[model samples]
Target: MSKVFRSLLLITALSSVSQWAQAGNYWKATAKDGWLDGYVEATLLLNGNLDATSIDTDVDNGVVTLRGKVETDTDKALVQELVLGVDGVNGIENMLTVFSPGENEDSAIQRKLTDKKVATVVKTRLLVAPDIGSTKIDVNSSQGVVVLEGQVKNDAEKQRAVEIAKKITDVEQVVNKLTVSD
Candidate 1:
């Protein structure tokens, strides 16, 4: 997306929160008002630029959660700094794991596959229709909480992603941080 367009959308999303702040269900209204797009853009840019081995971004209800895998614990601090600058990002939770050298590769693979199973369940339930923008959706799992990030065509798809994420077994929670394109 063009930088100007993205900036404008983010601004609009943030402003919507203010417009609806007086309404009951303040946070829900804030989230529903459309700030997630800019938040995701901010997170993507931050994570993409970070030096970590792997980083995933998930934004839900204006809160951004990060799932990362790094070779060193220091990568966490560096990543936090990067994520803090994004607009409309009300909060962040770190769910990164550090793997030491000589760790059992087989066990790691098994663990990853297990996580992938959770991811697959989310994908199957949420993205069953090929017409949905599944390609844009990114799913990553760590300790069974499914993280969703992507741009959907509308609120229905966004809601669908969340519902499907909720369906994934063993997941403690579903972080549906999908942004809808205008």
Candidate 2:
């Protein structure tokens, strides 16, 4: 065989191998993303307050993009919390718009600010509480109502989450949706 021909053949073989590797990596990423998306959707469906049909989920490189509208800000926060618990999820992009037709922009912004403040305070309280595993807790607030969701090691942790949330000022109500791990 001519030396030039051998060189060309070698280059072609290397190129083919590189393309195959790239394709394999792409497929693996896609399959992993698909699995993560399914897991997040399943978790949302299991939550009674969430209408999974109204929310759309897409996963790319382990980052979840949530699109569509939820009934309240609490529902939007709930969706974020649920997706965060899924194993493969690295981050969440919550594009969920709270559906409030009658409320004007100013009022809506104010309400969101209040909810955020309440959520922040409660989360800080949970973080400082030695008895509660703050890492396992998810907090969401809407219109001064706080919702606590996640798994705790014992009933004491669950009750402690509720207590901390109740103690926060401007918290209209505390909804304890935490589950105790066996």
Q: Per the 3 Å backbone cut-off, how many clashing residue pairs does candidate 2 have?
A: 0
Q: Please provide, for model 2 over 1-182, each residue's C-alpha lDDT reduced to its tens digit, 9 standing for 90 to 100.
A: 69999999999999999999999999999999999888888777866556878899999999999999886665676677667656778999999988963244477775775577568657755765678764788999998899999899998888888987887666889999999887
TM-score of each: 0.37, 0.59
lDDT of 1 by residue, 40-83 (tens): 44444534324543667667676667786755443454455445
Pairs of colliding residues, candidate 2: none
CA lDDT, every prediction?
A: 0.62, 0.80
Candidate 1, 175: how far from true, in Å?
1.4
Question: Which residue runs does candidate 2 get wrong by more than 4 Å?
Answer: 101-182
Q: What's model 1's TM-score?
A: 0.37
